[model samples]
Target chain A: MDATFRAMLEHGYNDLSIADIADEFEMSKSSLYYHYDSKDDLLVSFLSFASDRFEEDVLTAPTGDPMTDLEHVVEKLLPLELDEERRAIQTVMSELRSQAVTNAAFREQFTDIDDLLVAHLRVVVERGIEDGSFREVDSTRVAEHVVATLNGARVARATTNRTGAPAAVRVSLASYLDTVLRGRR
Target chain B: MDATFRAMLEHGYNDLSIADIADEFEMSKSSLYYHYDSKDDLLVSFLSFASDRFEEDVLTAPTGDPMTDLEHVVEKLLPLELDEERRAIQTVMSELRSQAVTNAAFREQFTDIDDLLVAHLRVVVERGIEDGSFREVDSTRVAEHVVATLNGARVARATTNRTGAPAAVRVSLASYLDTVLRGRR
Candidate 1:
């Protein structure tokens, strides 16, 4: 999967080929074809694998604090600062997302990932509300809003890092909790 | 430009050709080449032309209210609601934005459009603040957040409309004005 992702990063979606993925994977095309029938099939599986890793490594990398946990999710998805490898990954993911617009297979993969993130966010927000740590706002709405902001930040960061857009996603989420959804207020 | 944009909508960035655009425009390929050196050059020009049209048609569309003015801008961009034609356009624009990640020309075009929108939003927020209709918040930051949310909403709308993501963008913006940034509070 890493090899496949790396290949996609080097040669974009349009230019990438199964042979390229096979070369990166250090495997024969016939063996690769035995596992996955087509390039789209392999790519879809790759997206699913990436989603699983996101769930394991990032979402589950938690602190006890709900706000902190949510912030971490956003940060993991889009770093306030990115090194070369992470930026390359983001650029490739951006391309995949663009593909998702019209491709039903990609769309389903994205939807699954989006649904997972939003569900986790809803749980955290609801936890805060139940514990009396946060004000009564619609948890679902807040979750949806946060996910959208994260997606927006990804797009913004891809074009220009100077906007502080990624930082603002964290700030806006935190500030919403402090100002609009603070129980103490 | 319309022919180019329409071709993009029909064929997408990956598949679109100069011949395709020229066919749509009912012009000779050489004539089109006389104007635009390559497909990328033509697409970039189309983006610039779209930006100009946005600046003229939507930005200058008037209402007495600043809040209404801002809403109009978002609506023009994402259309809180979308018909098939609008959705198709949004999908093509999404592809262009993805291309912008690696393409400097597209990057500059997107940045220009983003900067223009954000600057207009800042002015509106500042105007509200001066008129004593809003609380003191960093107008620039507010503008950035709004732009991010708008971008996020565009992605969300392209997928599942069930999330109410478009409505959420508007709701978040209005709620910011009414709650956190309310002077009376």
Candidate 2:
């Protein structure tokens, strides 16, 4: 999986081939073929692997404070500074997401990932509302908006020359949380 | 350009070829080649064509009312109803945007499009603030947030099973406008 991810970041999704991944892998080409039938199959498996990692890393551990948890998720998804490694991962993810427009296998995995993120966000919002940290906003709607904005910021940061987008969104989201989500009482 | 658009929607970006475009074109494949050298050339041309259409349709002819003008841009970008035609176009755009991650030509075109949209949005926000329709806020930041959220909503609607995402974003954005942008006076 690490080999595939690294190879994908290096070669990109379209130019990447099984041979490239095999070269990156410690195992031989024959052994790689024995595991996965085709490039798409391997990529599909990679998506699943990435999804599991996302679930474990972003969703599993949440700080007790609902607001802090929400901020944590936002920071994980759209970090203000985006170091080289995280940028590479985001580039790979963006490439895969574009494929999801046409490929059902990629789409299915992305759907699951999207669902998990939104669900995690919804739960955090609900917790905030229940614990008096947040106002009485629609939790599902808030979750969707937060995810959508972060997704947009990530895309802009990766695909365009908008290097400051993630930071802009971070500041905007912080103000949004303070004014819109925070409870008066 | 019409033929290119139709052919892209029918065959998709990956499967699309000069022959397919020729089939959709009114003229001969030889004539099509006379205009463009390769499939990538034709696609780059198509992107410029689409960008012009978007600017003329969405950015021009704004209402005198700043708030109404803002809504007009948002509605055009993220309509509540994704009819068959609009959905197809959005899918194609999403595909092209994905390509931008790996392809420089596509990336350049998309960068222009993104800049145009953000600039138009910033002008609208500045207009609102000047005309006293909106509160004192950072016009550039507000514009970026609005565009990013819409972009995110569009991606979600295209790639995932989140059919209600556009509508949800529309509602959320409306509320955001009311609370955040609207002037107290």
Candidate 3:
């Protein structure tokens, strides 16, 4: 699964053939097929896998302070690494997004990630309101704002940085948190 | 040029072929060569052309209230089918950003657009302070935040809308402007 996921990251799952994967892993197509049903299956599996991990991290992870936890979540979720792992995840995201345009299955598979993130943000906003960390704004809408800004920054960082410096991602998240949580009074 | 730009948007510039563009346009390779020195020329021209028009409209053409000018500029930049040409221009912006990463030249071109937008935003923040439209903050960085939100909202609307409704973009922009500029003092 790691090999398959990494392959998808470097070259999109849509762009790669089973032969390509086999060549990378030094295995035959029959062997590869034995493990996975099809290309889409592999992608769906990857999405499910990542989504589970992300949900656990965002929702279940123990972090104190709503603002700190929110900032930490964005920092972790950002694909800010030059290694194959980060690239593979980014390629998967980009691929899933393109396929989601016309295909319902792909859209359904990836929608969970968006939902989980939004739900997590909403919790943070609610807590912020209680703790007086945020003003009286619509929590859901603010959550959407949070998701939009982070997603935008993620996509921007992916394109802008070739070596994938964590600094850019960190600065962006800090600024985002500062602005969104601005004027709590 | 249209074919190259379209190809870039659909499949990314690196993924598309000059032959695909040449055949689609029904033009000889020689003629294509005459018009453009290289594929770089084709892609750069598209970015340059779009950015040039965007600069003139958003930056050069001014309503004179730097604070309100930006709000108006965001309006002029993001419009509904209430008009045609404006919609087309915004469509171009939302579409190209997806492919901007694949081409280095195009990426650099986009950075210029981002920089110019940020620079103009800084001017707005500074005037906003004087005009009492905004409280004091890091004007330069705050400007980057504004552009990031606007650009992010544009992409989010492109991806999330089922019927391609333009209303989502407008409401989000209004909300963001309200958040950023509210005196709250």
Candidate 4:
């Protein structure tokens, strides 16, 4: 899985090959094929592995404060500055996401990740509302906004030259929370 | 350009070949090459064309009301039910956007589009603030959130099974405007 992830980062999903991975990892293609039938299968496994990592890294480390916990989630979701490997992985993920437009398996796995993020946001909003830390608002709607804005920030980071896009998102999200939870100015 | 757009929808940028596009369009590859040097050039031209269409279709039609004008921009930005052609164009755009991670040319073009969208949002926010319809806030920051959320919504639509992702974004954007513009709940 590590080999596949590393390989996919260098060679995008469309160009990723089992032989290349095998060669890079010093394994025979047949040996590699024994575990995964094709590149797509390897990518699927990679996606699953990524989801697990996200769960372990972000979902598990929850502070009691709903607002702070939500911030943690955002921080984990969008790294301050993606390193080389992180950027490569992100590029591959973007390719897989574009593929999801036609590929069902990719779509399902990506959807699972999306659902997980949105669900986490929803929980945080609901908790805040229940504890009176947040004003009464539609939890689901706010959750959707938060998730979408984060996703969009990722896109903006990848596509634009803007270095402060993530910080901007954080600022906007804080304002959003203030509007919803802290009431009017 | 129409031929290129249609072909790109079917075959993403990675797999797209000039021969395929030429064959599909009944144009000789040499003839196509005479105008555009590479697939990237063709794709770049297509991006410019798409930008013009967006300007013509959405930005040109502005209602007097800032709120309604903003909604028009949203409507034009995120088509509710993308037909086959629209979906194809969107998929192609997605692929090109991913390409921006590596290709400087694609990155510049994508950035221009992003700037255009953000500028539109900024204008609406400014107009609202000027007219006393919206509360005084950082127009630029709010515009960034609006653009990012919409981009995120597009990602969600592509990756998830959520059929109402566009509507969800619309609702979220409306809520954002309300929170910033409409005062307390």
As a whole number from 0 to 100, the lDDT of residue A95 in candidate 3 is 50
DockQ of each: 0.59, 0.74, 0.30, 0.75
Tens-digit lDDT track of model 4 for A44-75: 88888888887777876667788898888887
Q: Provide the lDDT at B157 for model 4.
A: 80
Residue-level lDDT of model 3, residues B148-184, one tens digit each, is 5565555554454422223443555465556556633
User: For candidate 3, what is the interface RMSD?
Assistant: 4.2
Q: Which has the higher DockQ value, candidate number 1 or candidate number 2?
A: 2
Error of 1 at A153 (Å): 1.2
TM-score of chain A of 3: 0.74
Q: Against the hidden true structure, what lDDT does model 4 obtain?
A: 0.79
Candidate 4 clash pair list = none
Q: Of models 2 and 4, which has the larger lDDT?
A: 2
Model 4: lDDT of residue A64:
75
Which scores better on DockQ, 1 or 3? 1
Candidate 1 per-residue C-alpha lDDT over B131-170 given as tens digits, one digit per residue, 9 for 90 to 100: 7776788888778777887788788766533456678667
TM-score of each model's chain B: 0.89, 0.95, 0.71, 0.90
- Could you give me the TM-score of model 1 versus the true structure? 0.94
**Considering lDDT, which of the candidate structures 2 and 3 is the better prediction for this target?**
2
Candidates in descending lDDT order? 2, 4, 1, 3
Better of 3 and 4 by DockQ: 4
Per-residue lDDT of A147 in model 3: 66
